[model samples]
Target: MSVYARRRRRSGTLMELVLTFVALGLLALLTLSGIARQSAGEPILPWIQPSSGNHLPHGVNYQIDALDPTTLAPMATLPQKGMVELRLAVTNDSALPVTFSFPTSMQCEFVARKVHTYVGGLFVLPLEVWRSSYFHNVSRHASRLTLNPAQTKVYVANWTLDPFDTGEASAGTYQVSASFGKSTIPLHIDKPL
Candidate 1:
């Protein structure tokens, strides 16, 4: 082959090598971007299942119960301007005492007014309401609590109803639900009188 022809062929091969490297680098960059986007995407959280009388590994048992106002005062008619009491039972099913730190709000399928009160222990305190602009002025509060094994503590929740508030809704039957962790209990609030 002629010297000029051979040099021309070599130059062409070098150009092809450079282009190939550039293309490979761009592909690597795109793949890295895609992976970063996938990681930044929202994470799927596992659903929390209800406890089937099984104690948590920490030996803590969380439960919710409704205190029938009827037994005390006919369940407080809607717009009656009174308090509906709820009892939350925390028991240590393990062999040792366990301390529980309460969370601010529990996830649920619906919305309603809520308040928390710790009772029957050293952490006894007044009721605290979960306050929001969507609802009336109420303070939602919680306190750290501890329980001994086989010991059960009751936390009282007082849900206040304003006869005039009616939750800004027209007169109708409304289902009020309150939840603590995985435990939820609902109450029926009839429309205003």
Candidate 2:
């Protein structure tokens, strides 16, 4: 080939290479900006669902014990206006320890009439009302427990129905929800007549 022709071909090839690189750089910039816009609020992982059943992000398993009143059996009955002592046990069922936060509000009232009745009639006595107060006062500081691999800890959640505050909650049903970050578990509560 002639020298002039060879030189022209080499220059054209270099220009084409530069243009290709510029196009690729622009594409990369656009891709990054699009990601930033989509994640403006919070980062979402396609494989991670914080609200999934007791499974932690790193494969940690957790157990929540059924609430048992200290003075009565799990299925036993008690006065509507008395204190109900309960404990929540968390067990780490994995090989590694996991750290998590607990929810403050778990108990919900269903029967407004029963709650009012109990509050007005039975919870009048300070001592009887104090029994239920113990759990609420102490539970505030009992959360934030850490567990090692195969470790377990108990958390106390007390529920009291005052005699004059409201009626005894109905005998139907209620729920106590436990939460950590975006994860939560709801436990059913049966009110005794």
Candidate 3:
């Protein structure tokens, strides 16, 4: 091939390669912005759910339910600014007394109410950070409760959003469940009025 012809061919190939990369880069930017515009925010996945009939292993049944402490009624959704208490009704099927140990702190999540409650983990991150990081569990102490066989006692863990918190504590479906030994349940929570 002639020298000039070979040089021209090589430059054309190089230009095509650069144009291809520029097109791909523009395409990527457009795709990412479209995704960002579609989502309200990131989906929260805080607590891992279980798949089985019973997770409690101690022959003790722990039914985790929620109560509106003010109304003293069973609740499906907790008020955003009010208190919703998690009640653990413990029944020992065994023939002996079992001591129940509640975790230091129970977790609550905002979720979507539907066929399945999708947990919103990040929604409550600010509250958690305020509780643990700022407060640091000050003045908290250890306590345990014992239950007799065939007896069912209800234990409570209450949660509420601070009225002054101006953050996005949106009203929607939420759940609060605690694990005792190897069992846990999800409590339903609703957004504030």
Candidate 4:
């Protein structure tokens, strides 16, 4: 073969190899992107089987329960200054499947007592709402969760409480609650030690 023709063939082969590699690289990139979108932190989450509840006569029935995070035990009272977790378990009582949307952050507040005291001089503090900083800047995206008939789903939310404005971390009973829609779970908190 002529030198000119040989050089042309070699150039064409190199161009073909480059184009092939470019196409393969793009295909790999597309595949990796799809995998990344589907994998939402699988390393942190364990697989949980769906549990079914008994069919009820009413529609969706929701029960809110307070639990201690450290022990995973049910709680009736919490400490004055610590994290409180409220689990809202919703049972689909109707025959139809229901979809509910709730924010990732939970809304909660504290209610203090107002009484006539000789030492504290009529100590009465107004209600204090615990603010969550999770979705402060970005607009919160509500999660659309669905529950089939007779299926129960429990959602957990936590709130950390601080002392009163007057630094009155005194020994007194207070009420704290987490509310979702019209349903709420009210629990008492003992005085901070």
**Every model's TM-score:** 0.37, 0.42, 0.48, 0.44
User: For residues 18-135, could you state the per-residue lDDT of candidate 4 as single tens digits?
Assistant: 9999999988865554343223211111233312232323598766566788987777665566666767676888899977665643332223331212223222232344433344
Error of 2 at 190 (Å): 2.6
lDDT of 3 at 26: 82
Candidate 2's residue-wise lDDT over 42-99, tens digit each? 1232233323334344644444433336634553443466555555455677787777
C-alpha RMSD of each candidate structure in angstroms: 15.0, 17.6, 8.9, 20.1
* Total colliding residue pairs, candidate 1: 4
Clashes of each: 4, 20, 6, 0
Local lDDT at 147 for model 4:
78
The alpha-carbon lDDT assigned to residue 11 of candidate 4 equals 100
Q: Pick the candidate with the highest TM-score.
A: 3
* 1-193 per-residue lDDT for model 3 (tens digits): 9999999999999999999999999888655543432231222222434233345547677676667888778876656566666677768888888775544442222222211222323223212111212333523444566767788766666655556776445665444545454454444455555
| Pairs of residues at least 3 apart in sequence or in different chains that clash in candidate 3 | 77-190, 78-189, 78-190, 80-192, 171-191, 174-189
TM-score of candidate 3 versus the correct structure, residues matched by position: 0.48
lDDT of 1 by residue, 1-193 (tens): 9999999999999999999999999888656544432222211111323223232446676654434565644443344455555555667799987765555332222234322112221121112223212444333564455677899876565555564665544344444444444444445445454
Worst 10 residues of 2 by lDDT: 108-117
Candidate 4, poorest ten consecutive residues by summed lDDT: 37-46
lDDT of 2 at 180: 41
